[model samples]
Structure formats: structure tokens, C-alpha cells
Target: MQTDVPVTDRTRVRREPARGRYDRETVHGIIDAALLCHVAFRDGDSVFCIPTVCWREDGHLYIHGSNGSRMLRALLGGQQACVTVTHLDGLVLARAAFNHSMNYRSVVVLGAFEAVPDDRKAASLDRLMDHLAPGRKHEARPGDANELRSTTVLRIALDEASAKLRTGGPQDDEADLSLDVWAGVLPLAVHALPPVPEPGITRSMPDGLRKWAGA
Candidate 1:
């Protein structure tokens, strides 16, 4: 059983405290369901927020990028960083315009990142491959020493994270119930399109691709 991360000032959802959840289940669920995260960090006198691919491995959220990337370099300084992931599930239409809002699941993590050692980087990155597509690591060619050397892998513990979510339909005022405007939810999701094969490839779609395509 995973314990809930204690909420800190940074991870606290001030706008609507009722929507915030500090449970591990909610945080992990939001992280696992997302393919992208925006990392916010301070650099010199300025702050930067960068979008990158991310994956969850046990108690950590992992991210990788070129060694030359400024964002990655900035995160390695042991400074506290903020990472956020959001999924827009739907648009809640209300009879009153003021009551209109978006249905979304969002997570906020506040922690300092640490670099994965050279020896552990490969194995750590394998988790990312497995997360993206099971069995894909076996089908894909392994990265060479130079390739690995040019990449940087970092992770932050999920010890100070919180999740905020809004679900269900619109909440219109009783007075607005008689309004002429339509009121309902417009649901949304990330759809996976069919795969496109390489022109010169003689191989058929692999099992992993088939699974990704919902075959």
C-alpha cells in the first residue's frame, strides 16, 4: 500500500481546495494516464516551463532529454521543481455562461530532480519503453554508448504531490435552469490512429504496434 504524499504549500490547490486530493492513488493515476508533463523551474532570475515526455516508475516520475538541453541541465541543480500533468476529459456546458467550466484531471508534483547514474540510466529508460509499449524494447535496437552518453535521465520522488480533478456534468444555478441555452458535457479522449509503416520496411506490424492500435 502506498502512502499519500503530504501536501506542501507548493503542491496545494488553492483555487478550489475541495477538488484537491493528496492520496497516492489519485496522484499515481493521473501520472500514469498522462504522456506529457510541464516542468517548471527557476534559472537565474527567470523561470521556465518546458513540456516533455514522462513516465512513472515506482515512486518516481522519470524524464529524459539531450544532455545539452537547458531544461534538463537546470533541473539537475538540486533546486525544487514543479511538474504538472493535466487531462481535459470534457467541456462542461452550463445554462449560465459564468458556470461553464472544463472537466479535467490534473496533478502537481514538487521535488528536486536527481540524475540517474550512467550504469542505471539504460535500465531506467527501459521502464519508459515498457510504459510506451510493452515488448517494444525487444523489437527496437538498443542505444549505443555514444547515444546514451548524449542523453540525460532524471527523476523526482512523488513524495510531495497532489492531484486535483473535476468530473461529471455542469453545475448550473437553480435560477439558470430556465435559460434557453443548452447544457451538457462534451466528452473528450486521446484517440490513437492507425499506424503508418515505413515505406522500405518488409516487416509486418509487430504485436506491440497491434496492441497500441487496439488490435
Candidate 2:
């Protein structure tokens, strides 16, 4: 779905000019690949950024944490927040130090957060798990009333979201082109490791997971 995030010429933050992408597809693709988000919100005079698991469903993003956390409590108080998710693909090592950079995809959402009602909390939790590990929610233990009571789920509508991305080689200045130095990005990606089954809980890892682990 197309986002309502405005891409006014003046509103663009001037840093990495080529890195900014306004297209929703590119933005959402990045969000889907990452499992964590950093939510920044202000409480009184202080600004706090908290890292937490997030899930996107029906054009809204959901995040949860301990009910007693000051960050969640502050968000429940109806504070405006900036939630961001970023994935660093590689380090851009340039011949010139000034041209050094990194390839990344990131999304920034600014909105007013609200406390999800109790009725939808369980479903929200399910979405979060599915976001992190699809189909695993049904296979795992469901949260009990006590566990639910200790958690706070907050939802932020994806209406006002903006995504920016950077890729490709380093951009060295014309003058710096003459420098005798190796200059290129060292590409990086998340490599899946062999699944180490929980010591006491092994029912033969699922085939799909075993394949992922080269079992």
C-alpha cells in the first residue's frame, strides 16, 4: 500500500542525498527484513530510544514491552514517538576518508502511540511472533493471563511513515580520485548459522529448520 508520508523537497534531511528512497515498496521491504525496531519518544524533557521487537500488520506497526517499563508507560501516556528500523548491509570503505559510508535501508515513523486494548493484546502478541518467526506462534506456548498482564502492547499506524535507503559504491570527490588507496564497500549480510536446538527440548528440528541449518 502507498504510504501518506509527504516527500516535500524541503523536508528531506540533507545527509546522504542518494540514499533517500520515498517509494513505499522499498521501504516496506526493508521493514519486513528486520525483526527489531528502535522507538524514540519524549518523556517530560528527556528523549528515550528503546529497542524492541516489532511487527507490521494491516498497515500498522505493533511493539510491546514490559508493562512497568518507563518507555512503555510514557508511550501509554500518549506521547509522540519516532520509531525507526535499520539494516546495515555493508561498510563503505572509501579511498578518501570523507567519502566513507555504508549501505543501509531504514524507515522512520513519527506518530502518536496508543495503548492497545486488552481484547486485542493477545492477537497483537501473535502478530509480533509471526513477524519474527512465521508459523511458530501456533507451535509455541501461548501467553497466560499473568504474562499478558505484565506486558504493554502499543500500535502505531503506518500512515505517516518515511523510508530512506542507501546502496552502491562510494562517492569520492574528483580531487580524491587520484588517491592511491583501495576504496570500495565491504558488503555484509546476515548469515544463518546452524540451528542449535535447546538442550532439553529436541523433538528433531523441523525439516525446514534443519535444511536451514544444513542438517
**How large is the C-alpha RMSD of every model relative to the true structure?**
2.3, 3.2
Error of 2 at 46 (Å): 1.4
Please provide, for model 1 over 1-215, each residue's C-alpha lDDT reduced to its tens digit, 9 standing for 90 to 100. 23378877877789988888988888998998778999999999999999999999989999999999999998999998999999999999999889999999999898899999999999988888887878888888988899999999999999999899999899998998998998999998877686677899878777664444531
Q: List TM-scores for all candidates, in order.
A: 0.94, 0.87
Q: Write down the lDDT that model 1 would get.
A: 0.88
Per-residue error for 32 in candidate 1, Å, reads 0.9
RMSD of 1: 2.3
Q: After superposition, which runs of candidate 2 have C-alpha atoms over 4 Å from their true positions?
A: 1-4, 8-11, 207-215
lDDT of 2 by residue, 111-144 (tens): 8888889989999898876765567688889999
In angstroms, how far off is 15's CA in candidate 2? 3.0
Q: Which candidate number would show the highest TM-score if scored against the true structure? A: 1
How much is the lDDT of residue 66 in candidate 2? Answer: 91
